[model samples]
Target: MLIDVAIEKVKGLISFFEGYRETGFLEALQIAKEIALEMNIDATFRKRRKIKRKKQFDENPDDTNIAPQSAQESFRVNYFIRVVDQAISSLTRRFEQYEGYQKIFGFLFTSETLRSLDKDSLKSSCVNLEASLTKDKQSDIDANELFVELKSLQNFMPKENIGPVEILNFLKRHDCFPNASIAYRVLLTIPVTVALAERSFSKLKLLKSYMRTTMTQQRLNDLATIALESEVLEKIDYEDIIEDFISKNTARMRMFK
Candidate 1:
């Protein structure tokens, strides 16, 4: 997906989540309560029924004070709020990281973003990217080389605005601009959302249990990839897989036959 589309999607999800948490959840909870009442079950949370004692003069009142809250209100505050807040926090962190990527690769992401940059700003962005990619005296692309390549590229760009995918395509067809091509390829690799990655992690938790702590990194990665991409696995013909396996394992194939 395009960066702009990804940004919009992230914003939309955040807004929808916040709206649901603020109002929609409570509305749904009220319906649930009604249903519970109809079934003759307790709708509200169990009371704490705390036994209070007189405070000593040595203790500060603020240290021991607990605000009296209704059972339902207490449940919402202690349980629901904490759960939703964790989700919101994770979203906020991912959004912030995405924004940082946009800042570094923003100009290269689209023709509009690229065109808006002047010579100096464009050079500055390239330098920032070069620094980010640099580690232990190694770098992916030279900032000076990239800036020069982009300037040449701008002259050949079409009147219609285009995104990184199109720019990569053009570079591939021409087979020129080595630095610019590298930059675009790296930009395209950035994830639009963390959903798929996080989902894989959830699968990974189940696959790599405490009992299986001895799994190698490569093996674990392979297992996780297979688990997450099960739909692709389902689409494959079993006959073709059997044939591939047979070809690879000649001794086993002869024994089976």
Candidate 2:
């Protein structure tokens, strides 16, 4: 989708340049400058209007002095644009952390990198990983050892079967290349979204309402974990749990026997 938008933007720019060329340089410059100035003025007006509308809404949130639907529609469009802009800005900021990780992962999984397994390419991957971990001050691994392990692993594993899990398993099986394995593990642990955290919060709310206000943190965590992994829980045999429960109590064990 981003590619499509970029293509269209490029096409628009081409058309713009062609039109300007046909109209002569000086005329085109004047026209372009005027358009830019007008756009800047319009943007300023829109910003002011948005602020004014927000202030009005804050003053009277009850919809008592609601504007006409046509006016409201314009406000909605402005509101939507503001929201989208803010959301994109927030997402871009969050993605900055993963940008280095992305480059490292790309290098790790690439056919060329795997086939070559040279010191230079491996060093570049290490640099990319280190940049991603800028918050941490120390680089713990031996670079030469990591390179050797990567080359050995690449030779052992087929290109067709290479993936995140496969690479992790290969590292585990060999029990070498602690640094490279740690990097892969860290990459695997990175959350793709906040949805899981949000879901846990939602579950907490449901589990520890006013009735259950005295629940301990440990118990709440246990319950929440169970709630989240309900699919796994569903597969368990309740009869086995019952037997285990009975065995834990001597009286119940005697009764069952």
Candidate 3:
């Protein structure tokens, strides 16, 4: 059910995180909760099981290591919840801190460096450091709009954080070509999260569509390779290579001369 819910809400979930980095933890947890709900995993079930186990332990406290087992289980459950909650909280705080620093200084640092400095760095750096990092000083362009656009990016994504087109449009809205260009530059670095590449490869697996029956695994691999490398096959006698293999195997009854 959670997977179904996730599938249905995938678009919305992505959009939220796209605009706001802080939404990452929340989205991850939401997805996890949705999955757990779908799988019918509940606190009630865990609690009931815990109670039953506790009774068994109470009846034979001397014989079994029930205390340690219970402690470990409780620790595991609490650890899971804490880890999820901490991640969400950290994301929110980190994004805000980054935004604050950028607003005052104009540059976003790498996480390592960002973690080192305090508010002192903000005063020392220019107000447009982040926006100007991507700009040519000779251009003498207004940097305010770029900062405005950056700040407007929120944690709540409408659906699918943002698409290429929407991000392009967001850049256009700010009229900060330098920042927009940089955004696109960063965008290209991210691999497409969609499974289009995998699906295309899957099509290669079905290359034996010409045959009706199930193909032998080896034959399937050969067919897939041939189909994928069809252009290269045009320049080589691939069939002859396989025929040679058959000849080598079939005509191998040699006697000592």
Error of 1 at 33 (Å): 3.0
Best by TM-score: 1
- lDDT of candidate 3 vs native? 0.47
| Candidate 2 per-residue C-alpha lDDT over 23-81 given as tens digits, one digit per residue, 9 for 90 to 100 | 44445445666887988743222333333434563565656556545443454356544
Candidate 3 residue lDDT tens string, 64-137: 55353454346435764566456556555544544453353323222223233454453243234444445554
Per-structure clash totals for the candidates: 0, 0, 17
lDDT of each: 0.85, 0.63, 0.47
Model 1 compared with the native: what TM-score? 0.67
lDDT of 1 by residue, 1-257 (tens): 86667777877878877887787667878998999999999897678878788889999878787677887787778878778778888877777878888888888878877878899998999999999889999999999999998888887888689889998999998877898998899889877867878997799899999999999999999998889889998998999888888889879789778
Of 1 and 3, the candidate ranking higher by TM-score: 1
- The TM-scores, one per candidate, come to 0.67, 0.51, 0.22
Task: Give stretches of model 3 more than 4 Å off.
Answer: 1-73, 76-78, 97-257
**Candidates ranked, most accurate by lDDT first:** 1, 2, 3
Residue-level lDDT for 83 in candidate 2: 55
Instruction: Please tell me which predicted candidate would have the highest lDDT against the true structure.
Output: 1
Clashing pairs in 1: none
Q: Give model 3's TM-score versus the native structure.
A: 0.22
